[model samples]
Target: MSGPAPIHVVVVGSGLAGYGVLRELRKLAPDATLTLVTADDGHFYSKPALSTALAKGKHADTLVTTPAAKMAAQLRLDLRAGRGVEALDAGERVLLTTGGPIPYDKLVLAMGADPVKVTIEGEGATRARPVNNLDDYRAFRENLPNGARVLVMGGGLVGSEFANDLSGAGYKAVVVDMLSHPLAQLVPQQVGDAIRDALAAQGVEWHLGRKVVSLDRADAATIATLDDGTRIEADAVLSAVGLRPHIWLARDAGLETARGIKVDATGRTSDPHIYAIGDCAEYPRGLAAYVTPIMAAARAIAPSALGTPTEIRFPPLSVQVKTTAYPVVLLPAPIGVKGGWRKVSDGSDGLKYLFEDETGRTRGYVLTGSLCEERMDMDRSLSAAEAEREAA
Candidate 1:
């Protein structure tokens, strides 16, 4: 006479979503068998800090707050690091990995996004570095010497942050982008100009309204040729164009996907037994890449996947830009809303603006400079429905 086997849960990722669900699941089902599988070393670090790390003088190993061994022991989990999923067998409720087949009663997919890849025709085309993880950041830091001239592609948030960080640390950072303004996709023109000016005052060279067409090696330095017929020489090159979710794995396994894996408010995918979260999940509005949304998803997923129905909550949260040269906090207006941003106030250090819709309703807002302290008050003024509708 043997007792019944414990329920097993398998998670395919080692990022915030995977660890988040496990931390919450342990609170609900302490005795449930838990396992975590990842292709990397499974070290825990703040992914957002990678852009601003140069000013703080943090190495790759220094960025890791906890290692795989510690996380597994603390949660009493079976940790499978340095392993990748070759294929997913949804019909049989099993995962095909490099090690072997792993059957599970429930599965969680927390696969994060990858940098959008673009090809450039040149000999040094292989020199474009994108730091999306600890290992990537480690290599980036090791390759650059103090005061080295670095060429940065894209004027988005990540790119701007890195430019500010590098310039603040005495690195000669030159930025090239097709957009005429900084953060053209996220912020208003006023805010974008403010970011550009602030970083420019910090020694960051800007080549806006232009893009690198090709990269070639020149002795010890790399030469980046611009479409505007300008060639910039630098010791290193970095790319931060955009991010794309990991949707192929789910799509190939016969799961619904659009932009990212489609999931309900409770984080449940097309298959009830499997749930998706983080950058890889597409909510009703869009993919919420910020921290607060993913934490809420994990909380609901832990209970919902364990036979309990729990809906995730999307509160009005403010996204703060980590650039030290300029301070920014914003909540973008909802998509398809007939609205325009109007400058409200100008302070000594920054400016404040509000997004008003056609009907004169306040839809969203962005605050810069000294007015950034009003973020919490402004954030609460917006409704949850409109706030959660932020662009992916």
Candidate 2:
């Protein structure tokens, strides 16, 4: 009889994916020796809450419902915080870290992503802030003066959310970006227009079709010079350009990586013993950046990690509008899949856009305002289409 199977497991990263993996593993293999490692403070909070943090009057500390100590205690797991991974030895199944090398029967990389950096010339440019983690938020909060003039760079989701939250927090917020509207690439132009109008009413200024060329320190304020030579003075500048998957380590370790670390359906790397998930892992089909897909991947990978035969296919996610003001819902067309959008709009108050493929089957949809009434029908249609595709 085989002695008790190797009981060691090492999970990297402390974000949602890492924690979720641990949570699922504990339920399935309670006797397994589990060790979690992370490079940052191990506080646990819903990261999606960061989008509306300031507007909800919540500080980073308040967002953390479970501290790292409590999490480790509750799960009966060993937790390592503020430790950076040095390298991966796939052949040996060892993880090299600042603490030391850890050998594991299974290894999970939920490494997450890093904020993209933007470079601008000027004195305070080097000091410009990007809030990617709790420490960064704390640093920004400490450095920001009361009643400060804040200039946020970018017009995407994070930038728009930051602008709204900061303005709601009583800061004089100004957002500058090259895009014509907020969430320009993600949502349709009509929806963008509505959001722009709503945000403008809330005192968020839009600097569309403009880029900051330089940032300099001017006495107590920072001066941001646009490409067109227009100068805007602000107390601080917050850069929210976007995020790129942290894939350098994976790449250096000789793992296949593109926009993200490439992983199979089971989150397995090129080496079967190692696996990846969350924002850091990229599916061959495309990047699914939302939390829903991350959860799906984790659920599928857990059983496989425990040596169970589980073949699960990720289903297209049902997107719901979390913002109460606009009351919009969308199921975005999957990436790499071509489709056409059929739209019917009633000014800014009601709008519906359906994305259908070559066969006239509904693959995705977007509904806003009163048009949300057809969501059930749209979902049913898509579900039937998916079923048919599976059967075929």
Candidate 3:
């Protein structure tokens, strides 16, 4: 009699989450057969590093840590590169791709999110690059002349970080956002002001509480008109508005999806044989688009996918704001949770704010500058459950 067939696992996507699970699963079950499929060339690179790479002198070409073939060889898996998964059939356990139909005992959807499109009218509007990936970064860098003035739309984490990076890289950065302050998605007003001051010192211009309603061309320059009738001209436009999870794949396959592909605590999708992880997945803790949660989910997902169900849980974690001028460690307040940020400390040492709920429970916290060292204390106090719930 022939030996039992090896467990065949097909992983879609070539990003961090895909590697995270594969790395773990390989160690656990070396005999398992793995197949990696992706739309890109499958060059391994860090997504978060794109914003900070300019200052570090790293471009798209240098950003790739490993090539796809090497990754497949290292992980001992079948590499299917430059193939887009067109459709998925849950009942048949098959995936329709650009190449052909591929069958697997288990499937992992790690296909990431896409840039949230923004509506801006006028001539230069189409010139804006969301800069969400290496390709966009490459194009942005090529178009950016030395000391170019970049108009960054959105004062959220990505925009603020890019502005900081551009400033550090000897370029002028002008930021615009409808919110009253930078990092308004999470940080308190005072913290935002501090960041504003820090970035201003680094030569970053701010246009808070205003939206770029349109973009026009002036001579060789791009002119951005704000909602309040304020016009600013720059060399290039970079968008950092937001990102939306890829749900069409899961939805087409009849898998449940919300803000993202819905997954249980163990990262298993509605279809028990199929699983979702990374930015594409909205798990029990919520939408995990960051590294920490994705890694954690990957750990639990590996064993569970192999017939050994593991309860996925998070380790102590906090998302760091990457403005080197004034660094920040923050746990964003949970959505639908009533809470208010209260100052814990602020002075020459830096700023700290604790997000407390109506019940006086510390739900989240933000620490900046010197106060960032206290991240461990904050991490310990913030239960892993609460941290997982809110930090994502």
Candidate 4:
């Protein structure tokens, strides 16, 4: 006589977060039924590599490390590619997709995030593109002519990386942002200045403290109007403003959402059987949108999804900025925490900055250029300080 039916775990999205869950779950329960559903082709590629591929002379197709079929065979997962979930019925434990309804014992949401689009007025406004995915990168490359002058909007991590990559690929890159310096949100002013100067030496133009007001087509080129009445002509524009979590599905399904899908320490949503991770999941402080946090969440949530409950405790994770012109590693202080930044060292090679609170507790740190090699050591120091705070 057959015993209880095999538990089927359905994971939405095939990106790093979803794949991480699948990998960990398999190790815990090798015979567990697993299915992966994604809107795009389920090929495996490093999402971070999209920003630097151009500099390395790599195409979108070549970026994929493993094909979908091969990954499915190796992982023993039921793969559903190029199919989006139309709706979700949490009460019935079913996902409504174009193919059909998929019944599952547990559901995992790792739908990722969407690029934030900036609205501008003009005929050439539609020409501005964002390279958030492989398909977007392919289209951007196809539309860009040789030696094209590309206008990059925003000065955050993604924007800085793209600007450097474009310049390295023999294309002219001009970055425009409303902030005074590049990566103002992530790094100190001095660090940002160093990066701006280094990238400038490599032929990248910086148009800081100005916003793109509009984009108008003039003859064969696109004219970008800045807030300060400055005009620049370019062949293409790329916007790397930021990313917003894709939480519409979860919110519409009656799940709680803040900046992202609200989840507990165990990655469990409002519904006990539903869990989320990656950029789409919001923990207590905020969304941990980086790779390390996602992997940590996946490891903590896998056992819980498989019936053995576990909780996640995220340690401090350093963000490694992918700007080839000037490498940077930053561990930002917690939001709203009272602290002040102090310059530790400034030399020809690079600079180092640290953040500490009133009680002499080290909260965060940033290292640039050759000094970035001290990342692991600084991370350990930060961890020790955190341990002391907790012990007290």
Number of the predicted model whose TM-score against the real structure is largest:
4
Please provide, for model 2 over 284-370, each residue's C-alpha lDDT reduced to its tens digit, 9 standing for 90 to 100.
666776777778787877777878745446666656554444556778777766768878666545788777778777767778787
Going through the candidates in order, what is the number of backbone clashes in each? 0, 0, 0, 0
lDDT tens per residue, model 1, 1-392 = 98978779999999998999999988899999999999999988889989988988988898999998999999989998988998899999998899898999999999999898988989998899898888899999999978999999989988998999999888988999899888887788878888998899999999999989999998879999999889999999999888899988899999999999999989999998999999999987778887888898999999998889798887765688887789998877766788788888876868888888998888778888788898888766675445555543
For model 1, give the RMSD to the true fold.
2.8
lDDT of 3: 0.90
Model 2 TM-score relative to the real fold: 0.92
Q: Give the TM-score of candidate 4.
A: 0.96
- Per-residue lDDT of model 4, residues 1-392, tens digit only: 98877789999999899999999988888888999999999998999999899989899899999999998998899999989899999999999998899999999999999989889988899878899888999999888899999999999989999999999999999999999899888778999998899899999999999999999998878999998899999999999998999999999999999889999989999999899999999987678888888898989899999887888767787898888889899987766778788999999768999888787677788889889999988888777876787799
Query: Candidate 1's error at 153, in angstroms?
Result: 0.6
Give candidate 3 misplaced runs (Cα > 4 Å).
218-220, 384-392
Off by over 4 Å in 2: 318-325, 347-349, 357-361, 370-381
Per-residue lDDT of 1-392 in model 3, one digit per residue for the tens? 99999999999988899999998889989999999998888888999999999999887899999987889899998989889999999999999999999999999999889988898899888878898777788898987899999999999999999999999999999999989889997989999998999999999999999999999988779999999999998999998998899889899999999999999988999999999999999887688678988898888999999989997887555898899998999988876788799998979888889999999988789999888999988787777556566678
Give Cα distance to truth, residue 365, candidate 4, Å: 1.2
Q: Distance from true position, residue 70, model 2, in Å? A: 1.3
Once superposed on the true structure, which residue ranges of model 1 sit more than 4 Å away at CA? 1-3, 335-338, 383-392
Q: How many residue pairs of model 2 clash at the backbone?
A: 0
Model 3 root mean square deviation, Cα atoms: 2.6
